[model samples]
Target: MKDIQTHDRQRLAEKLRFLEPDVIEVITTNFCQQHPETKEPGEVDTTHCITDARYHLTFLRTAIEFGTEETFRQYLRWTTKVLQTRNIPHHVLQRFLEEIFHALEPHLTDSEKLVVRTHFLDVPESGLTERQTPARSESPLALHQEVFLQALLAGDRHAARTIALEALSSTHSLSDVYVEVFQESLYKIGSLWESNRISVAQEHVATAITQYVMANLYTCVTPSQPSKGKGIITGVEGELHQIGSHMVADMLEMQGWDIRFLGVNIPHQAILQLIKEFQPTLVGISATMVLKVPIVRDLIKDIRNHFPSAATPRILVGGSAFRALPDVYRDIGADAFAYDLRTLTTLLS
Candidate 1:
């Protein structure tokens, strides 16, 4: 039975490679037909059509390469997000998944058939059943962004901690403050620096203050229970942005994962050594700049080559770099790419 399963998995991979172009065409055609609004009259290219086709193609490639329950779920969840962004109805997204299944049916072996049947075919059609995407109202912490920013700018770590603690003391989840308060504030700071409204030194000072504030809140978030699993979060070599990765580390730590956070610009040797020593269940690497992307890709390549198949950790990639470049994570060999803490939580959940 194991041998049969292995053969079927390999067979599916091969078929996916050979049939990709055809599969993409099928998916794109179905998507266009289902949502005629996606097609613009007398236009050589439409945003929806291009994005839809690329999304399906990337999904197929990533799904085939990873072929795990977690990866499959990421694909589905990402599809739902894409559909929601386009303001397309949830039901249309449901039909899209169904079309992908139909498009690949002929290529699936009996064993593969059962795999997709359970994971894809019979999976919850939540997108189809739901009338619309659930509304995500503004976070209450967002209302205090000005206060947080002011404190950080003033280099008042005390004031920042007070604000964060007050939010955490409220009904808000730790995850909420991490996203709205820290992430969004840093984003605003960066924008200010970019527009010359704030100096580079000011940006650095604000970020340092915010990091200090995050440190102070750690005691509040530290889990009492045993760890769920081990996790390693870091910025790839040549990547200087550690705050984003640090936020992820905190989130995982709060969730009771024995997490090792290797701060900015860690070498491949150190990372590989730690992974082998720690044998973590998950590894998250971040690259804030586009130039650092190649470092991430190389890191993944080395990890795959050095580690035995079973011992390999589930790799996740994130950062502003991937946020700007859509679907690049699929090509970079990471199991999943999270655009932010919210998506990261969803991916892990």
Candidate 2:
């Protein structure tokens, strides 16, 4: 691969930030085909597509297991469309299916690459099965998000997601739920996934279901409330995680700050450009994988260099990677380590 240009790298990182597996493959195939080397189903392009496909696929698998079907189906259509048109490689497709639906692989019972192989035959048959009866599980919600989520978890994701939508709509602000209600629920779900009580797919399902409900609520948000200070949060060039930043954006928004969410896998230059353009009060960086830690440190250093003329926005760092080495925050020259959303209350204060 060529030395990726700074802006284009960020664009690629952001382009398919949260795409499902099938969609990522579709995108990779299209992207590879657009380039000279990747046009054919060669081994090199196949490898690249496979790697990228897993990122999208794993997330979707998690979502399907935990989130509402409404959320799963919403993106399912988009993914299916991409699969239908994009010329993805065979083995790569199989690998993606294997990762997401691991348990089902054994059930293939001697069939030759049965799992993803069949799904690969046609894009439309990507198994976005809405008609399958969800087992009745949760109590119907007259009000409360608890009831909604309980219902959602119980197999009536359609109803759960719908109620969540109503709850989000009733909120005076799009960001209102994040501080306590949403954050707490997210943490609980994470715990469930971590404890092995729920699978990664289930966690993903919950996030997808919640995100869809939130997206609808966000659209209705309309920024009716007046703004305060502005901020931007992004993952460094090589990093792909965006969950922590989502929390920051919501917290800042709830606190009346105008936040610009540049999103996952953003490059140093793009962030710098936004900083220069928006003149935000703080710049937040999130890194989920430890291997990407240097990217975060370097990005902060670069941002510091670019804003020499005035008060550089405070740099904030957070994510799983930082959990082990909280001291790294100081070494990296970040002004704040937003270890939690509440940390911002003090920093922004």
Candidate 3:
């Protein structure tokens, strides 16, 4: 029964994807006609409405593909807070969601419409209260993490690098810096962006600073022993979040693995060609967005098809996607899913 619902949702998502442009147009037109106040200068204009409609549909499609409303619900909750922070009235958000549902109605079957309506039934109410600071981690390097995060938020690359290097020089190991500082800080930055506590530009700046800091710290990471095995780490296609993958590659290299870190959004053919040339012992794929899990699954399938069972590299998956659905890797035929660097190294060992 569950599998049948999942299939229906998948089909619905695919259909919506095909009709995205038309659906978005209908949503924008209806929203404008229903709310003329939004068309005023400096208000939510047609362009903004179109963009929001696209994102709304995209998030809904992802939720359907996941076979759970939790994904869409979470996005709606975050968006509600963000809109409230921007002084956009709560009613406008509600109206936008309603417009989306009506726009999609013409394209969906009665059953599919019911599934979509379920996703919209419990819209989150907006709150005007200020977002509280995220709680501090209990890690010993918590202080360093806090300082590093503030530095990144402030766009002080030098301070961020110095904090990371200083922590590495102290009693803290490279793993501590990566996990307790970099990973934790990035997570907090994501939360801030979702809550509208910080702008997207600020979040990008923080990520860039962290990447810079990681590069500087790489100079200090020397393997103490011979190579354990060859490995390739990359983000799945269309996945722009590569910092976590980069950290995994660096840690693996430090563990005496021959690591090749291919950047994000790599093509399937490119990955296969690399596998043929490199013949790695392990291939680590990262997909930060839950929506990209299907792409990861397909990539894994391609790898299996192109290589004999005995020749295929041990496929390991990770990132934020698997954090919520830890067993999904097994479902996708991946050999393993690592939540963090320690788990990954432990699995390899």
Candidate 4:
């Protein structure tokens, strides 16, 4: 898997994304035609097939680009549970995956074909049946997280803000509020959506509420000490998840690092220009989706190319993208990878 060339992975990912709509149409249409019973009244809706196909293709693209076949397999296992929750037959999923492989087989190189076959196509149905449940933490802030999550789920931004502020006023520090309450609650909301227990709208609302609360809490954040150095943090291009980066920015600001957060989907040239203008001591990049890992690599490469080796800022990376593959930062030429604020502080020290 590591032997797969970078350009080949990038090319395959781009090709898969480009052919997404056509491939989905071919697979879904053929499945409906061959399994007409799926479209019968009260049976599996064709819309579900289209939705699943889109997610399937996306997972495939990310897995290919990141050279993490386990990512795709994990997605399959999770989707199996989600489909079961929705009353969709397991065989329908199996058949759809087969059709997808056949649809793309003609376009793949012999080695790529073998990869798809060996990693994706050969998984036993029995192996995919394992169900996973979200774990409960018995930490001091778990109760606060539960209440905060409920408030967000109810779209009560005001209540959520109160909860967060109250937690901050207690024994919890600012970092505790951010990590234990805000971050943990958001993680639960995401898991609920993934397990098909919550609608997309609900997830969005919960996220928006959390963002609102975070902003409200920011007013209370004061630097514990004088400024140490300047830092610029941003989510990589095409990475829409910004809250993690936002949290990093705030935490660093509170720790007395002068921070300029550029938000999400920032272009590489724009980032390079900013680095030149700001001349920060640290450049922090966040990528949430595995699909954006290649973009992060390319961005880091471009940064290295644009600046002289001695003049380059220490580039640090974090976010959920690297959670399953922590050493990916080393592979991508990053100076360091920090999993959270604690590790970030250690790295800077």
Candidate 5:
């Protein structure tokens, strides 16, 4: 990577001053035209688009001029604050960075392009390190792993349910079994697939078995008599992994929130509609893949724009994606993050 100190910010500033107006206009026009259907009367319309464009232009100029890791870090902090408070989508950051590249590409040389791409854009989804299964000290569940694995691989939902129900009957609360047993089982199965110890079909079968067992356990959850608040939970668009988010929804339900759990792969517009209809106090979004973090950001941003400031729900995000990138959920503009179900319960409580 090129060192930031060696570059002349003045030169980039001069270029940016010249280009900023046109860049903003181009971006605003294109963004508005592309997402006209998102516009609501007296809400996120032309003025909001213009404001977003201006913000994007200012950030890009600052980044190119400063060109430092610290600058990007600070920007992320400020941007995340806006995301949490103002309803800016995470993808808007990505989109703005991309637009800057398009605007500057014609006038800038290759070296300058590299700096912009490296410093402000091109963040690896799961961050810098190679991904690994989180290290754990011991199994939290009481069930025999060998038997659970056999039942899952054999596609015996009844056996899986029995094991889970047995745990519930003995020492495990629903939450404990979920995190200790089901989550652990999924993790082990995932590891097996990673190491070629299990077939994709077997891994899928395990997931299905767990899902069935989860449903069996659901009827037993007893929330406090009065509801705490309302919540709507979902996965981002194109994300099919519903288990983690569903676990959260169930936990929240047990905690006395009126839960409207919309599972995996919900469209953006549909989420907004639900937010309008459900009128939740909290919105829990989950994404399993790094790429979908942008979608979470966008979802939050859209929620901010679509709802009145007071009415917009507090956003909570979790899942493997956040676990892999420790600081990313904040960057995505979530009000808070739940690293695990225990943490989630505490945050909600």
Candidate 6:
């Protein structure tokens, strides 16, 4: 095997720059105080923090390698420790537990893992007569892989790049592992939230981690074009929840969109100027939260007013918040609302 390098360590260091200087310092101090032998303890703090994000869960092989029945059980029992801390909320702890356990259960012994799945994970053993069984192929996930996730959760940008390079060298790209495995892991986080097995704060921890994790992924992949792929995609003013937009951006670029991604919080006049500047073949807007409807409506109006030549470059609206209020689209006035990335691709060029 090729030697593991400092790329992961560096990611942790860079991410520390974004954190509360004191929080990073404290984590470093604590990690050093705890494990001094590791010369690169700076990044280790991020790796340590992400275990709670449940990166271990989706990549079952990784979880099986780093996770223990003991750790898994403790995550399940996070409320006790959190309660003792007296600072964190109960839901926060619950979300941490749910994500890790859901992803790991498929690899764990049926009897032990099933207990939580039956009670949580949103999948019932009694329901699916045909379920996937664990395999050796599913085990042996690298420590660096789990560490990369931790780094991203902790906002350790350097660690993100480092582990990403490490993964890339091993006959696979991070995207090779990311698209399906990690996506499923995130789905588990959402499933836990929708089911009430985990608390909202816990869900936010996972969501925050998941969102930033994608941000980290952007750093690893070299940009073929500065504006995403080669074109442009954006959301309306006040519509943020770039998660859905990011996914669509990735998928669209893969399908040759030459992407220009204008992430959430864009305003009306700004978008009009952007439309004129970029002259994109298509315009995609994502609305994951509710308040974006008005912003989107205004965006459509401005697009027509300024770029009347383009008329409509396939306006698209997506995300859970928009999906929840399909009725609002009549008021907002978009050409289409996509359920997922593939559908969005079909709707546009």
What's the TM-score of each model vs. the native? 0.61, 0.51, 0.88, 0.87, 0.64, 0.45
- Stretches of candidate 2 off by over 4 Å are 1-158, 162-176, 219-227, 309-311
Candidate 3 lDDT over 48-132, as tens digits, reads: 6677778888877866776656556666766677666566777787778777788878878898888778655446453323346
Clashing pairs in 3: none
Model 1 C-alpha lDDT per residue in residues 1-349, reported as the tens digit of each score = 2233544554665676677678777776666555675554455544566566656545444344434444445555655554554456566656666777788788876767676666544556662332444866776777677789888778788888899989888888778888888888888787566445777899999989888888888877657354578999998777887999998998887777889999988989999999989999899999875546657888999999999889999999998767755476776788999988889888887
Q: State the lDDT at 100 in candidate 1.
A: 71
Model 5 lDDT per residue over 176-277, tens place = 888887887788788667555778898888998888888878987666544788889999898999999889988888877898999989998999998898
Candidate 3 Cα lDDT to native: 0.83
CA lDDT, candidate 5, residue 2? 26
Query: TM-score for model 1?
Result: 0.61
Ranking by lDDT: 4, 3, 1, 5, 2, 6
TM-score of 3: 0.88
Model 6 TM-score, all chains together? 0.45
lDDT (Cα, 0-100) at 4 in candidate 1 = 35
Instruction: Name model 3 segments beyond 4 Å from true.
Output: 1-5, 32-44, 119-137
Q: Which stretches of candidate 5 lie over 4 Å from their true place?
A: 1-135, 140-146
1 Cα displacement, candidate 4 (Å): 2.4
Cα lDDT for residue 136, model 1? 65
Winner on TM-score (3 vs 5):
3
| Candidate topping lDDT | 4
- When summed lDDT is taken over every stretch of 10 residues in candidate 2, the lowest stretch is 62-71
Ranking by TM-score: 3, 4, 5, 1, 2, 6
lDDT by residue for model 2 over 58-174, one digit each (tens)? 433322222222333434443443343344433344344444444333433443233233423223433432244476444222235466456535546576556656666564333
What shift in Å separates residue 337 of candidate 2 from its native position after superposition? 1.7
Pick the winner on lDDT between candidates 3 and 5: 3
The candidate with the higher lDDT, 3 or 6, is 3
